[model samples]
Target: MKTGLPFRRPRPLWFVALLTTFVLVLPAPAQTGQLAPGVRGLATRAPKNMKIDGDLAEFKDAFCTPVEYFSFDAKTLRNRAVQFFYLWDDEAFYAGLRTLDEAPANFADDNHLWEGDAVEWYFDTRQDENFRSQAWPTNANPGAVHCYWTGLKGTNIQGRFCLRPGYLNAIPKIMIEVGARRTRRGMEVEFKLPWANFPDFKPKLNEVIALDAELCYSDGGPRIFRTFAYGSPLSVQQPANLGKIQLVEKLAPSLWKACGPVITPVRCDTAWTQNSRPQITGYMAIPPNHAEQIGVIWRNGHVTGDLRSGVPARRRAVAERPGRARHVSFVRHCL
Candidate 1:
């Protein structure tokens, strides 16, 4: 049965202003990843609030393990299983989730079903900065970017999928249902999402993408089966800690040869390079005023080798001038 409720918008004005500032400060052509062809990994640009309808064979690694790093303690509900799947057509990227349980899947008492289970989707449209800003600096707030959640019973649903930065806050247009018969399978839920809702973005064929997903469940008495890419505490009021989700990397058509450096290049200026000390070097550079400037570059033995395998060597450069010493220290501080 379909419950026809008017769409609800739940974002506050201050949140909008914060988002606007974030978008304005975002750098141009934000770095993004490539989505791989076929159906093994995440899509290039996943739909905002879509319920995917497909097989769950390929996504075993993503959904099988119970996330121990970020889990909540409530009444323990046993035998809960989750599966994830992703696909892409010419127009949109699709994501599908399936949750299996052995219990009756009750939602009637105090709307317990609505409270027990939730699925969350995080989009990294810009890919580079990971949709973060100095103001918010974190993904705890729903207003930070496009985010959505839906309960198992399909009540208490929230969504945001509009083009005007903050305007993405809107209700989902998908359907959620529970099994009518109580079989050995327990309970199962399926979800589908569309691509149009994701704005100002495009994906190259077979471009790997990065995204995050969370599955939460309650046993009607207490929270159970709570898992997330990142960790969250038991308090529902607290925002989910999203930093834990390991970034999903996608391989491009170019393969390793085309893949850029895994580690970004270091920016070192206002320092000098001196051969006098092999272990402790100097990075020399002319100041904007064209005056002679010199700074020391110190390297720790532990930090050596390719950027991917070992940590980069630490370097510190100090200028002889009075005020310039502080500038060199600031640069070294980053090390």
Candidate 2:
């Protein structure tokens, strides 16, 4: 069922101005990860007011997983600006993505999304113990699930595929929520994967799930090349190379504040690069009140710097979970 809600505009003028200034003057937000790629990291619980508007605000405090450092051709750096942020609640896994694509074109209705510019994901539920031993072109592996999103002419489409036995029988009706919007720089997509979709696997705290993310690129043809958060030339056929994600309890609001804007550790584009250019997208209230606390509302780029800061931080408890699939593969496909 759908409900109509008023469209909320950007934060107020004075407030946004203050945020932009802080973002500029403040040092880049500190993020923790091994200096290398494919490192395992933590995924936090979803924020209080999560929305699927294809904007980055709802991803605040979520685990910020970098999709950089992917290798292409085993010799060149697959340097495309893309980041994957995720969270979890009792029922589903949530993902928010921003990709830097200089030229976004390709609105195919077929699996050809992999051939054109798109975002795609691969997953191995690890629900079956023999999943680790499975290999190659012949194995559609009942354990694998693929999902992707692409856009053309203002229209957006998302699709899902599974390798489990009978196509319809093995795949449960996944409750998927997607929102794709073209940004000034490239493109951004947000989605949620309900736990019910993974009938064999139930998410429990502190458990590991095998996962990988790819930013597939094509000017308007078959997939020419791609980048990955994990998985290399043969890794797609070899699931062991995929990284792992550990489900954690929802983080505190204060932790989100500490992370700063969604586009932390700025890149070159000056327009919020997920595909190209990086620039301050917009402003968000810090800590305590978040964006809602801001008093004035301004359009995207009109705010100037007169701001206030008196919001206090609130604390909450960590939820509980104790199970994880032994060798699940998780992949995220996008545009």
Provide the overall lDDT of each model, using Cα atoms, as 2-decimal numbers.
0.31, 0.48
lDDT of 1 by residue, 53-72 (tens): 23333332221121221111
Model 1 lDDT on a 0 to 1 scale? 0.31
Worst 10 residues of 2 by lDDT: 312-321
Steric clash count of candidate 2: 42
Best by lDDT: 2
